[model samples]
Target: MANYNPYENMLQTLDLAADTLGIPRNDYEVLRHPEREMNVAIPVQMDDGHVEVFTGYRCQHSSVLGASKGGLRFHPDADENEVRALGAWMTIKNAIAHLPYGGGKGGIKVDPKKLSERELERLTRGFVRKIAPIIGVERDVPAPDVNTNPQIMSWIVDEYSALTGQWTPGIVTGKPLAIGGSLGRNEATGRGCMFTLLSYLEKQGTSIKDLTIAVQGFGNVGSVGALLMHREGAKIVAIGDVHGSLYNANGIDVEKAYEYANSHGRSLEGYEEPGMTRIPNPDLLLLDVDVLYLAALENQVNEANMKEVKAKLILEGANGPLTKDADLYFFEKGIPVLPDVLANGGGVVVSYYEWVQNKAGFYWSEEEVNEKLAKNMKKSFEEVWAMQEEFKVYPRLAAYMVALRRLVEALKIKGYNG
Candidate 1:
């Protein structure tokens, strides 16, 4: 993993896709870097009557399609390089999903868990104020990611509106229901993964009920994905979060586990149940399950641990969870690894819906939102599958091909031929 940098990984993938498509180097070279990057220093007054400074970043990878769109993560590990990589991935993800938007991502270098509620609000508002000049409904929209959530989004919307002196819910996605947030927005990513998996299984004459799944990363994406898959009769044998891992071959009660995690401060530590055994988080990755859903951070499956991955199918629910080396290893070993650009695009897809609803001032019901998401996800899966077969490449490269073709066309149309 020493040689792995998220931004560099994105560039290598981009280069491969462009070369495969025979796109002129000049036509797609701009995509090798972000169009704009904004770093801000946010100073917030703490509840203890002290001010703390935080560094934040918002990188707009591309807006060739339309307004840049992505999520804002709050983690101590947040930095410009990671944000740039995530932003670039968003560009690919949105293109593959066929959304008329580009890619952007923002994050602040602070641990939300260490701050009080009031302090978090202040920090969020300060970050928004600092970055508001570059973000807008028609410029770039931000959403929830990692430690950030709907509540933080609400704060951003309020702060941005206050700054502009107008109600601009369109300035952000993933807001509360009372706001302009679309229904089914929270579960969009997880549900999208489920839909993609089910569609792929059906095409192969297999049923989800017959597969045993182990989900690493029990956060919003992982927990919801595990629950939805479990609801569809999949046996979720193991689940893990930052705290620890839980295993039960007979299929742990997903709902109970979800509830426990939610009520226990979102950690699976000390959770007890009959027939359940605790395991290390890394061990969860080596579990002998039919499916492995990687919903954790990037590079979780690197060269060091690729050989130990026993799951027949690896579905990425997190961005860049598998490094290029690990991805190539899986391809060589004939293990089908679903790339994140296609699998975890549900969040951004629903974000597109939310953006639409915000512009139209008309919101759809949860059923409608989910139906649209499923249709889009299925369509994207078919397209990627076709590309994979046509090019005889892994899904990751195939996805990059699909996205690169779209992006290149947009660039050429915009008179960037040179």
Candidate 2:
């Protein structure tokens, strides 16, 4: 996994999808690289009165479809390649969901947890100022990922608005409700995962109630997805995060786990129930279960342990959870893997809605937001499934095919100018 390059992984899938569609590489070669990438050095004053410089990157993989949109993560491992790959995946995800947006992703190389509140705010503002020139209501919008959230997004909106001298809430999504954020934006990604999984199960003439699931990652996406799945009557056999993992074949209380993680800095290190047994973080992927919901980091199930995975179904709630080889191993084994472009697209989809509402200066109720989300998720998954059937390929490839076709069509319509 140390040698795993996410951008290269993205290219592998992109090439295969284009090949599957019988499109020449030259004609669609523009999609092979980012339209633009900006790197910034943000220096902020620390609480101890010293200054620390941080590296940030914003990669726009495409603008041919429409405006660029994706998340801005603050992780210790955030880098240009990862951001670029995530940006490309955003393009695919948005196209899969039929959103009128391209793909862009940005992140800073720092563990946001290590920063004091004031320091973090200053660093965020500095980063925003550097990238503000290129982002806008209809250009590029960023949402939260990893250690960032609504509060962080609010800070971005405030900083960007301050710099622009105009009130522009659409410059970013995932803001607070009082600031034009959509009603269902917080749980959009996880809810989309649930919606796609349920749609798949329904088509198989089964229900989530009959499954025993293991969830890796207890953050907003993983925990929300697990809790929602639990509410649907699935037995959550195991759950874990960076600190540790826990297993209880009889089923763990997902709601309690959600609350506990929320109250404990988003770590599942010390929570224990009567039947729960502690396990290593890596072991969570190998657990014998009906479902493996990976809402964690990238390249988790790579070539090293792909053969040991026992999950009958894999739902990707995170971008690029499975390496290319792991994806092939499962596809050849006949297991249905719900790709991220289709499963976790609810975030970008709702971000699109939020951007629209921000521009329109109108808001919808939570019911309306959720209704629109569920309908889009179900329809997107069905479209991907149909593409999979038509192509006789893996769902991931099918999803990439769906997205790449849209990108190519857009390119043709726009011509090769600028």
- lDDT string for model 2 (1-418, tens) is 6778999999999999999999888768998989999999999999999999999999999988899999999999999999999999999999988999999999999988889999999999999999988988789999999899998999999999888898888988998998888998888899999999999998899989999999999998999999989999999999988888999989998888888888998888688778999988888999989999999999899888999999999999998999999999999999889998899999888888898899889899988999999999998988889999998999999999988888888887888633
Lowest lDDT sum, 10 consecutive residues, model 2, at 409-418
Tens digits of per-residue lDDT for model 1, 106-125: 99999988999999999999
Computed on alpha carbons, the lDDT of every model, listed in order, comes to: 0.93, 0.91
TM-score of each candidate?
A: 0.98, 0.98
Q: List the candidate 2 regions with Cα displacement exceeding 4 Å.
A: none
* Candidate 1 residue-wise lDDT at 142: 94
> Number of clashes in every candidate structure?
0, 0
